[model samples]
Target: MQQLALFIRKEFIHVLRDRRTLLILFGMPVMQILIFGFALSNEVKNARLVVVDHGRDLATAALIARLDASRYFEVEQVALSPPALEATFRRGEVKVAVVFPARFYEQWQHGRDVAVQVIADASDPNTATTLTQYVSAIVYDHATEQREAQALPYGLRVETRMLYNPQLEGAPNYVPGVMALVLMLVCVMMTAVSIVREKETGTLEVLLVSPFRPVLVIVAKAVPYLILSLVNVGTILVLSTTVLHVPVQGNVLLLLAESILFITTCLALGIFISVQTSSQQVAMLISLMGMLLPTILFSGFMFPIENMPVPLQVIAHAVPAKWYYIIVKAIMIKGLGIAAVWKETLVLAGMTAGWLFISVKRFNIRLA
Candidate 1:
């Protein structure tokens, strides 16, 4: 009991001595909550929109005015032709384009139905779907108000078309983000601490004296955990598919391969962290502070990148999890193959290589 108490005291001393680790452990959670709460909300506002009022009547103008007055939308451009509308959407400046059909007001006057066409960018299915709903609600509200005041029989209908995720099930969106967060947490944190433990307990030097090559030593340490992570990957797959109802619409083998790649990338980052920090506390701090928060914020898990401040949006590109989330969504939701995800896969490969090259170089320098 005395020995155990002494060991606990020693651990406290060690933890207290490391200021960086202490700060990260205490500060990271607070920072993450604040960042995610304020900056990462899914609710969108001031979304860039285009309007084509073909009817040019009072009712159409009033509808447009109502939409423009709302804080959720921003009228960026007005297009008169279909080709021009397509060009505006393709340029990526506008998220949704609203078109009022000809005789929009006359139909309302004659007790006929009015149709408004809403075209949304399918690339970001969540925002696109949400915007389409917003357009409908606003139009409906405007018509209801007019009907109540004027006692008219006019009906207004909204036609919605979503480009990418036609069905806005949120699971597909979260599955990829979950993959990123889990891999980063499990791979980097565990591997980093294990490696540092060997060094702290003087087992690493003993391993160096043994017959095994240092690279082999590193491999032997990583291999078992890599296999374990595969089991975790399988569990996540089952959970996501059977329990969560987010099924893999793409090749199962391809999805497995991508998971392996992402796991390897995370392991490489762990190895890099292992090389940088001598203590388990520092390694844990790096994993939590450097990996976790960014994974949630930048991966577009909670916040739409379009709605974030420009600086934060730029910083998101630096997060590898951001790319992996996109890959996961493409494979799981869109069912896209390598042809579609090659760019993201390439980016992951590059990031993995960078981490490996740096870790190996640092390890070799230490040996020399």
Candidate 2:
């Protein structure tokens, strides 16, 4: 009994001595709980929206007021002309646009059915479809209230039109999500573990001391993984289109270009992880807990970002998968070209550069 107790005590001491391991063990669960509890939600809120009210009458004003009051929408601007509304959507400023016909109020008052056009930026088909539904429900409710007040038999008719994804297919929503998740796991987690394994075998130090520049050594190590990740991207694209029947509506070359960019980002993140940790186990754990969980929960794959608490939403913005997911959906589902998704691309490029810079700096400091 004494021997067993001594063995247990020794193991505990060893565990506690490694503060990084201890911190990871304790911090991972808390992070998962906080993220899953707060950040993971399907409900949409504060969706940026634009309104164009040609009616400009009491009825139109009341409907717009209802939308503004709802938690689901934030009325950002009132577009003066159709071109202005187009500009807003083109700039990615708003996800939804509400357009009321010029004689909307007059038609409603004359006992005729009125139609309010709800145009959604279906780049993210799921968000676009959900926002359209929410707005339509609000419009229907307002029409019902007006009908009751007037003691009318018929109420307003609200028609919703999804711009990019008229069918609202689930594949379009999930394909990009799956791509982001898979690529992150393979590129980041696998590369991190591979690099850490080299360190554990004592070969990484030998390579560092080799005649080749440290940056070249790191790039050489990353090149194989980068190529593998790109092959995986091709496989995903093939499966998404052939087996899943999800069409690549945009330019295929452009999608490949973006995929390469995202793969670079993940590889840099993996290098950063490798630089931080010496143990393969630690690298794997961080990759899974830190990268995988956030990719799934905070990247709009399983939950909408707008539904998360404000602080969590801010954190979601930092997740690389979030931007890549948006880019994929915009390209694959919306058929939007690089022009429409330039901001997301830029953000991802910046993240990649930042991760690489930090990794290089840390690697140099460790060597010094």
Candidate 3:
């Protein structure tokens, strides 16, 4: 029993010495609990709602008040109409818009049929549907209250318009997210693992001693991966358009350019990881498992980022995949041009430059 206890203590001491093992054992569970607790929620609340109240009457005021008072909506009145509203939606300024027709209260008071238009940005079809449903229920309840108060039978019709994706298809929502995930995981993992493999086999050390600067050699080694990742982007795009029937609604060349920038950013990230880690296992683990959750949770594709806690929402901005996902959705789903996505594009460019700068600064020619 004493010998067995000694063996157990030795194994525990071995595990305690490995920072990586300790992190996996204790750090990951706490991280998962916090992230899953705060980030994984489907209930939408405090959604920005744009209202064009053409009626401008007492009844319309009451309805708008109710909507704003509801926990699900935060209303902002705007003087926007159909064709002009497209720009607002493209900018992601509002999730849903309520357009009260002119003389809305008068028509309802006279017992005439009145229609209220609810225009939703359906880039994320599920949210769009849920928001529309909320609006419809509110409208119905308002109509019922009005009728009971005045002792008159009149109704308010909700004409829902789901823009971008009229059919409420899932493909339009998930394809861009999948594109971001695929590019991030594939590029980061491949670049990190390939370079780390060279280091494990002693090839990287041999090349490090060569005449060329170590940074330049690292760039040379990673360039092929950048090309291959671009090819993967093209293949994914083709499959998305043909097999999935999610068309590229914006400039194809521009999309390709954006994809190249994102792939470069991911490659830079992978290079930074390879420089920091000596083992292929560590590189792969960091590239795959470390990046996977951030890309999914923060990317704003699976869950609405605005609904999360303020800190998590702030953290979402740091995830490169979030910017890429936003860019792809703007270009592909909304048919937006560079003007709409320039900020996100600049962010990705800055991230790429930052990663390259960090990787070059940290790379040491001396082998550890």
C-alpha RMSD for every candidate: 11.8, 15.3, 15.5
Candidate 2: misplaced stretches above 4 Å? 1-156, 364-368
Clashes by residue pair, model 2: none
Worst 10 residues of 2 by lDDT: 29-38
Candidate 1 residues lying further than 4 Å off, grouped into runs, are 1-157, 163-167, 309-311, 364-368
Number of the predicted model whose TM-score against the real structure is largest: 3
Q: Cα miss at 163, model 2 (Å)?
A: 3.2
lDDT of each: 0.76, 0.79, 0.81
After superposition of all CA atoms, the RMSD between model 1 and the true structure is 11.8
Task: Provide backbone clash counts, one per model.
Answer: 2, 0, 0
Report the C-alpha lDDT of model 2 over 1-368, residue by residue, as the tens digit: 45344533543464457676445434433343334333544457799888888888888888888999988899854756778778778899889988899988889998787889999998889789899988988988888788879888853455677887565445567778878877787678766876787778877677677555667656766766666567667766776677657789999999999999999999899999998998999999998889888998999978889998999999999999999999999899888899999999999999999999998888752343
- Write candidate 1's Cα lDDT for 1-368 as tens digits: 45344533544465457675445333433343334334554667899878888888888888888899988899753646888778877888789989998899888877676789999999999889899988988888887777778787544545566655565445566666766777777778867886788788887787667655656555555655566567666766776677557678888898889888888888889989998888999999998799989988888886788899999999998788898888888888778899999999998999989998888777743332
For candidate 1, the TM-score is: 0.60
Model 3 ranges off by over 4 Å? 1-154
Return the top candidate by lDDT: 3
In model 1, the worst 10-residue window by lDDT is 25-34
- Whole-model lDDT, model 2: 0.79
Cα lDDT of model 3 by residue, 213-313, tens digit? 67666666566656656766676677667766789999988889999999899989999999899898899899989889999899988889999999999
